[model samples]
Target: MRAEPSLPRHHLPPDRLAELVRGEGGPETLDLLLGGERSRRLLLLRMLDDATDLGPAWDLLSEAQRRAPQVVDDLLMYPQTGMWLTTALRRLRGRTPMDEPPLWVELGHMSALAAAALRAEFDFTIEVPVRHGRVPLPTLGCAVLPETEPWTRATVRAEGGRAVIEAAGAEVALPPTTGSAGPGWHPVRRLTVGARGRRLDIVLDDVDPYRTYPQPTEPRPLSGEAAAQWRRMLEQAWELLLREQPKTAEAMRRGVFSLTPTPAGERFRPRSVSAGDAFGGVEASEPDDAVQLAVTLVHEFQHTKLGGLLHLTPLLTHDSDRGKELWYAPWRNDPRPLEGLLQGIYAFVGITRFWREHRRAAPAQTAMAHFEFALWRAHVATAMEQVHRHPRLTPLGTALLDTLRDHCAQWLAEPVPEEPLALAHLCADDHVARWRAHHRRPAALRPSTGPYGHGWTGRADRPAPWRPNPRSCPTPRHAGWTAWRCSSATASAARTTTGSRSTGPRRPQPGSAER
Candidate 1:
């Protein structure tokens, strides 16, 4: 057998190498080792792979941080790992430019995710090693752990750089941090405030409470009036949202709807969001957050109440043949009731009302305005077709359908020139397209596909209609037949074409018998 070639020395297992480096025995153990850059790169990649397969690597980083805060510095200076380090730092602390010192460069390379996670756990910044040549260090402005105060008050003690928080018969251990051992206090320079209904909660980070709002002015550090103003704003926004709930609820029932509360600060932060019956959650961006939250709540709610009813219910399950087809369709196949269709129309009406009420003072119209119009047109078209095809409509059903059509027509006639152009065109186009697609399908025949080609097959022994006349029913505006009509025409044509006969009326329009 040929002698096996010697394995490359750098190909050592990552865990074993990491252990040597952590123990400060790596360089001495491997004489062939060149620089820290190569070793660090290999180590970091190993860590990353471990993180991907096991869980977030933050836990390992935290343990490393405790063992040696300088470990981060070493990794940052390590050439191969430096890029990822820089990426992580930027993600955590925001981007820092190159003109900054080498220390800043190393600091900038820190992972944002790591920082956020660590910040929640400890108060420590990695120090750059001076031996690695002149590297700049960026000063992280005053930052404090949000959980520190509560942890301290609860007689938190740290073991092996990990903190143990005991409160109300509950004991929780927290990892150790540089700050927890030092003054254990930082100034409160910023506040995160959120308001829900009448309740407003303020979180002060690295700030003195006596200086913040809800406290007497003299003892505080920052401008007391500013803090008080912020409190007032939070309260005002909360009140405004609560006051609008009734109208919001009504609007939501029509279509997708949402509500977002404003955050407490000069910059508008969204405090909370509620979306239809499906989903709603908070976001960090201040200005867009409030608007998006409100819109989501309203929009989703509309889907639940109005959109839900107009379509077929129990939405075909995955096992159903139609359900499989629905998966490929862009739109969901949730069932909707006639009442839901009306509700969607009403939602559009409500939107019009809302615009009239707030137009002059309102901010720019949101995308929701256009969305509502689209939903209204769809609901109206579906309802109209349903009414037309109901062989014998109930008195109430007929009245409702007629009323909705009249309302739609009135809306169409409105002098708001811009309003009619977009929606009317879309409605008309969609109506025609829907009819053509559905009416021409072979599966749409009334009884079944086998016996009929285009017209009805009345009975086995009896004759059926020969050719359907255009005059049999009024011409569809979009030239499409309803489901029932489509089925009838299909059966009749198929029966006549397949050698079956019909005794029904003859063709009416000139082209009725052609093709």
Candidate 2:
């Protein structure tokens, strides 16, 4: 296995990392770690070194502090406070350089943060009113770094239609514009969809667009032209949901109550994200058309449902001896863990299903939809193959895999056009080739036995059989299609004829890579 990055200097050392890992690092350590920039920076680097550009990440943090300066003290009071947002930004931008950290890394960090909160024993959440509606608030972290050098300690609460902060023998009301209650609390609009019996309030929050998560994009409310565009998009999305994906539409009706409308930097763009069950809402940007928006809705809601399921049961069993390795996900340029790969399959299953239906209703979009169905179905089937080969799943996890596998099987069995099938196979071949180049060693040179294989060493461009057997690529055997085979001679001839002046494997284009 490859060695990981070293720890940052003048900060948390190996012993300190052990302390944290062992749960021995308590309040004193938290205070010390939070008091300076070094410890916090080190913790973030450890969690995200592979995926993030450290300089750009810090630049984002500087902008975040500028936007919400009040949180600076809070950041210094908790070791992991600044990371949640910045790491989220990194993931949103697909900046992860390698595989994501294991689930425990994040779960442990959040648990530690929760444990250190002054209000944890009370088990409560603060609610602050924002012009149109009240939002749930997180417990204010320790107002003072207790038992440390003398520092200001304050508590914020809503009283008499104003937010008052009481600290160190003084009381002051915070002006609404300067300070916010905290992250995750924001003003939002309620969008009630469907009829009386099935009515659901999808809270439309434009706040994500305003946040610094994407960087360079400052926070701004939806208004004037932006607001008008949002309303139209929502209406169209709602209509498509009711028509195309009734079950997922019902999931939205039952499981989702909040919708955050993030701004699309460009027109005719669709963006949708869900931060798991902990953050109970879907954040989506305006889409080019209702069909795309409908697909985004289905994709995110699947994540919301699975996120909740994850809290109740373990999916992948923990194995201490096994190192975390990145796998090739057809949709992403970087690698993903088994868990992240599983989540991607879950979300895209619904998306593939959406395209399965839309391919018929919208003739103009049929080609694209057919292609999407073919791509996602094949990828999902491939992921199921990986899971089956690996035995690190719990009983419940095995059951969950069965359910998803069954869904993929049915989808894969659906008849697809030959053009779509060819496109999907080509994409699979490209992704596998890239993965082999990045992670695996080349096949050893061997004497050729075939008629045209004379004196040939194994080279990707030569008529060599790829490990994935790309030329004789196998689709699901039960899917009623014979394995698609391209003659090695033909493949080699094409590469030679094209003189491709290879720039290297192509990185995924924007809008082409989905979460």
Candidate 3:
């Protein structure tokens, strides 16, 4: 009998898992999460190959693995590759319909990863597909071939030691080592924020075909002015986290790998999301200022951490999402699954923790900060009550829910200002009434065929008004909307403990808006 190859195994001790349950962990925890992702990618590749004939793409990847292992690891580690690999496998297994990119282009992604690796470390000859005159190299960037027509393949032949993209009769230069690729190559933009001795590196990923998960959009790279603005805002936002919440800031630096910039929606609202499938990625609309930007980073990063944690071990004994309507989450307009409910509670713990510090850390912004803290603290505690003792929860789930509840419990002793507390209460009551109206069936009011109080009032027959679904269009987001919009330049704010500078209440800039 032939011996099968063995795979690597990862084990997390009980204490380390406990730290993550409390919504707190250090480098070791993050490393475990990300390290697990690599193993997942390897398994995905093996399955994908067995399910379909990957052909030369598989051969290219095998060669690259043998000749340039480091480059192979680096390219596979890029987060968007995770999204692509999962979606491609789903397509192969008939879990999802074969859609627009077509199965061929999807398989071509493996070739793209292989090509990028070989380009970085070895001289290799390969042919990569060009869809609508664009060659997308997974991590590097997309090479636009204006000179070539539709549905073609670009040949990458080594000119001496360098790999160049050539299609039709023209050669497309890769993003430069020393200079810009000019207009032909739109490279993925990597931006960084540094404070004290620590730094966070993230890609503003506008070039990948698979970057969009929940809702896909066209690849729209930022204009020169817009890219510059993103750099400025990110630096300012990173500074705020480093100053007020260093530990959370460190957590972000450890995990968050990329942000896919979504177009801005209506004023007073900003949108952001992260998913369990895409562990280290976030999709967000540009916020009004640095503080709002900082909050979005925290909100998305919390989801990222939880997503990674769920991958490590099972929380529920059975599927929690066979029907999501069973669980009610205050932060969402729609009901969540038990797992989804838990995700919301974990994220709000971080958000509430941010505002709890902000109210005292920057006394000038106290009222708004107090409002956020009060609102989220109530909502999280409420959700925790529903899911904390779920019958389906394994002991791991129970531990996580209890640790989070205890953290929220500690915040109960902190007092908010009278005015903000009143406002928070009013908002909470208003949402409860609306949610009941939206979901609960009220008695149907009869026509005036009879006198008042004489008419029969059966259960209300009609459904609630339809709001925009995220699966279709951009709707006004209620979750992070309140935290991001400064709404005006006049709302001046104070500095942090170290006395560095960033935006307070941001005014709309001449050319800036979310999009």
Residue 115, model 3: lDDT of 76
Candidate 1 per-residue lDDT, tens place, 1-515, comes to: 99999854443345433322221122222322323234444465455444334233354456656765665544333222334443334433445443322433233223322332333344333321111111111111122223322212222333334544343444433323422222222222233233333332322221211111111111112244654554454344334334454444322222221112223322211222211111111211122333333332333333333222222122112222221111001011122233333343333333333322322333233222332333344444443544333323344335445555565666444443244234434433343334333333334335444333323323233212112111111222233223223223323443433445422211101011000
Summarize candidate 2's per-residue lDDT along 355-430 as a digit string, tens digits: 7787777654454566667767777777666664457677656756676677778878888777656665665655
Between candidates 1 and 3, name the one with more favorable lDDT. 3
Candidate 1 local Cα displacement, residue 35, angstroms? 73
What candidate 3 gets wrong by more than 4 Å, as runs, is 1-8, 147-151, 215-218, 443-515
Model 2 clash pairs?
A: 51-96, 51-97, 203-259, 210-219
Better of 1 and 3 by TM-score: 3
**Any runs in candidate 1 off by more than 4 Å, and if so which?**
1-295, 299-409, 418-424, 431-515
- How many pairs of residues collide in model 3? 4
On TM-score, the candidate that comes out on top is: 3
- lDDT winner between 2 and 3, please give it: 3
Which scores higher on lDDT, 1 or 2? Answer: 2
lDDT of 1 at 152: 22
Residue 470's C-alpha lDDT in candidate 1?
A: 12
Candidate 3 lDDT over residue span 1-515, tens digit each: 98988855777777778778988776778888888888887888888888888887788778877887877887777777778888888788788885667677777877777777755565678888787888877767777776445566788765556657887777776644622555578777888779546898888888777787754343567777787788898999898888899888887787888888877755445677776677788877777778878878887788888788787787878753455335546666554566677777887788788888877887656656776788778778877876687777889889888988888888876776665666565555445444444443433474433222222232142222222111221233334322232222112222322143433442211111111
